[model samples]
Target: MEKFEQIFKYVNEYAEKLVEANGLDYLEALLQTLEDTLDGTFEWQVEGANKEDMRKAIQIAILKGMRKSAQPNHQMTPDTLGLLVAHFVEQCFEHRLQHGPIAVVDPALGTGNLLFTVMNALNGNVEATGVEVDDLLIRLAAATGDLIEQPVTLFRQDALEKLLVDPVDAVICDLPVGYYPNEEVALDFELCASEGMSYAHHLFIEQSMNYTKDGGFAFFLIPANLFESEQAKQLHKFIKGHAWIQAVIQLPENLFASKAHEKSILILQKHSEHLKAPREVLLAKVPNMSNREALAMFFEKVSMWREGNDQKR
Candidate 1:
């Protein structure tokens, strides 16, 4: 086995032992054990190994364990797509890094995979925070934060009802893809009645906007029905009124490699009175390609569009 794989195996075994002894959750045990083991140069067989790098790899191991145990309803974004979303955020907000650390939030932070990648892409030029309604996922996110040595504040609260004390620089997430189970929770959303089949994604999008500063960005991975169904027209109108739709990229079916459903990434900038909304939005359909190739193409086209070049396809 590869050296990193060896590290993962050892870490998993240690975490499992901790779970058995202390009756702790898998993620909690994994993180507690890893903190002791990953102090400095670890897995030296891997060239130029550092503590943080090893921690990142171990975090992935914990993520895999979580994914394996995840219920079908969890709706976690695949790691590759999470990386793509992070890349998009980094590219779009790279200029803001010069001013100060950009504050970013994921209202539906599942395992914090999206935040982790975004932090890496922006070279730590971010103050990352998230809210997760799931106890398991929130604990997992906290553990992942410890493993990666990334300081992320995660709140265990309903994303829709959570109040934002301060507006942030950007809001990004793979919005949960189903109806809110609790009607009381659903009632608080702006378009609760007209959100059609699923209110989670739309409501979270609205909540994200609420916490975003004027001229700040919000990105979401949502079902394609959001752009199709007649019920969503109101939501679209609301979006147009409140923000500028920067780009809508129709992702390939099976982009997540399971269920084979078509989804789109909506990149929106909250409207500011000082700046007029663009006359036209960039719309592109991503072709089937390896994740690396697809994300590279995406970043390239978006960079061009932001530079005032009209990007076609």
Candidate 2:
């Protein structure tokens, strides 16, 4: 094999080795079934050398692994997403991770990336609730919950609705957004931007702002456009009137499942008595167009922010 081919094979082998070490018996069983399926598919297609069949097998492996790995979100790279989420959640819940339990919520649970990552990071110090409008996603989240042997209370509700009234200790959401306004609303935000309202994604952030407990924190990943758009400006103007906007992390492009648009993660503290140092937006050019590395850079910065705050306190 060529050097590149050898490296690729090694990577795959190393991944399976890690899975073998970390996975439970149930996960092993599921992986076995998936392996059988892949073997059959590859054997059938090898005669004709059908590339599409190979792709299907890859998808099947991903789907099965996701289900077995307690992932509910389809088209998601759990390892990369989990690493990013767990990193930020650590910063957000470093204090609360000590207590018996705290309230955390993911408005757009998308296959439970934020939800499950938080669960793993906190090591179960938190009780979570997630809401997703997609039935397939809901089912996936439910299956992951079962696999993890935890109650990740999830609801089928629109994230763009008026209010979540009940306060939560932490909020993390990756609001869906596209280049066009209509695409943004229909995909993730789900609410129309009216005369008085700004835009759907921004609305999701604002509503989450209200749901976060006094002094609690919220982490949101929204399109970069939301920060520069006239709508975002007006919304920021309104937001400046209340709460502390701790920091904004501008992620590298293609950091999400879509791997197209660039987004930013904003940390907002709700009903807080104190204001932060007003951090300038941190910009990282995503070292290698890698979503995982980009997200890692994000929470690493967040950790720095938290440490600085701790020193001041």
Candidate 3:
């Protein structure tokens, strides 16, 4: 980890130097530096050291440093929550081998942590794409992809304005928190007719659902109080009409580095006439412990539920 930090620091310094010397854009300089140094910076001659290990190290190190230096986006999913969300996605694909090599998209992919984690959990058998409004975060995410030799298409467009032409297998995101001040952007009138547009997170969740194919999943880490908020009643009503609620996992408070608000991961499957919706949704709460025990327990519970479903079929 220490070595990784050193490498990341060197890369940062190199990018800054390039910016100063060439008068290049920050993102362009960083991209150039990453392309030139990724191979040499992580070269490890130690026995059993492989490109995969180097790639993981580079991703973690750069992500840690970038998070520290870059302007904070409270909307970004915390690492722990992101990992758990990724695991849930992997579980969704466990029994569906026919869809083995699925597509996962993150509409608000800050640093691409959740997106890449999902790819890793699936053992690199999936295609990953992300759309981020922030240039710096997207650059760092692209650099990580370059290092790992993994292809992840990142669009610079705002997620609110961009709609997917081709639906995907899963829509996974840690929605941007707080209200979206833009009232001009057209939204589902039903979501706004009752309470008007309140939070941007609500719109993002809707976008996630819309991005998924029939019978596909959309997972979001959102404010735990969302369900109780008066402004969200319309959002819930809209969801009831269009999607099947699958699971709601409450996360521990302070799981995020920026905010301590209690959060939850909501899993929804887009409305599908051919696939029957679950009679009862899974609602699980994780204890506030930082250990991996809580995640293991959650995984076990989900596995049991899935197995029961298989038996019924």
Q: Total backbone clashes of model 1?
A: 0
Model 3 Cα lDDT, one tens digit per residue, 1-313:
4544555566667767887899865555656767676657533233454444544555654554544454566134445776787778877777674556888888997767677766665676778888988877787678867666678888987787756536888999887877776666635434543445557888787777778898899998888788877776778887898898888988776565454476788999898877777766888887766567866786789888666553122
Question: Backbone collision count in every prediction?
Answer: 0, 2, 0
What tens-digit string does per-residue lDDT give for candidate 2 at 1-313? 3332343243335446546776643334333433443345211213342322332333334455555555333444334444455566677667767766878888887666557656766666778888877765675566555544457888887766544437888888877553224444433332334443445566667668768877787877767666577566556765676556666655545445564456666677765555444444334433443457764675566667677664222
Ranked candidates, highest TM-score first: 1, 3, 2
lDDT of 1: 0.72
lDDT of each: 0.72, 0.58, 0.71
Per-residue CA lDDT of candidate 1, range 1-313, in tens?
Answer: 5555666777777778888999877766765665555565232245555534554566566666666564664445665666667767876766677887989888888777777777766766889888887886676677667666788888888787866547988988887766666677667666575533446677788888889998889988887767666547768877877888888888777565554366788989898866666656779877666677876786788777776722222
Clashing pairs in 2: 72-111, 73-111
User: In candidate 1, which residue ranges exceed 4 Å CA deviation?
Assistant: 1-6, 18-47, 50-56, 67-70, 73-75, 194-198, 258-260, 291-298, 309-313
Give the C-alpha miss distance for residue 40 in model 2, angstroms: 24
Give the candidate number with the greatest lDDT: 1
